[model samples]
Target: MRDVAGSWKDLTDDANFMAGTLTGQVRDIAFVTTAVATGDLSKKVMMDMCGELLKLKDSISFARSDRERPLDVEPVGGGGTDAV
Candidate 1:
C-alpha cells in the first residue's frame, strides 16, 4: 500500500509539471499572436514547438513576414521609375 501511494504521488507530480509547462507555452503563443493581430509585427513566437504547435508557430511567422513585405507600385505619371 505504501509503494502504491508513492507511485500515485509520483504520477500526479509529473502530470502537474507537464500541465504547467503546456500552459506557459500556450500563454506565450497567445501573447505573440495577439500582438501580431494588433499590427505589431515586431513581436515573434520565440518558443520552440513540436507537431501541431509547430505548424501554428510557422503560420504566425508567415503572417508577420507577409505584412513586412514591401509592395511594388508604379509611378502615378508613368514617367518615373517604379517605387518599391
Candidate 2:
C-alpha cells in the first residue's frame, strides 16, 4: 500500500512538470504570434524545441525571414518601378 502511494505521487509530479513545460511553450508561441500579427517581426521563439513544436518554430522563423527579405530589395535606378 505504501509503495502504491509513492508511485502515485511520482506520477502526479511528472504530470505537473509536463503541464508546466507545455504551458510555457504555448505562451511563448502565443507571444511570438501576437508580435508578428502586430507587424513586429523582431521577436523569435528562442526556446529549444523538438518534434511538432520544432516544426512550428521553424515555420515562424521562415515567415519572419520572408517578411524581412523584401525590405532589402532595391530598385535599379534610384527607386522606380521595374519595367516588365
- The most accurate candidate by lDDT is 2
> Worst ten-residue run, lDDT, model 2?
1-10
Cα lDDT tens digits, model 1, 47-76, are 778888889889888988999999988658
Clashes of 1: 0
lDDT per prediction? Answer: 0.84, 0.86
Give the residue spans of candidate 1 off by over 4 A: 1-6, 79-84
RMSD of 2: 4.6
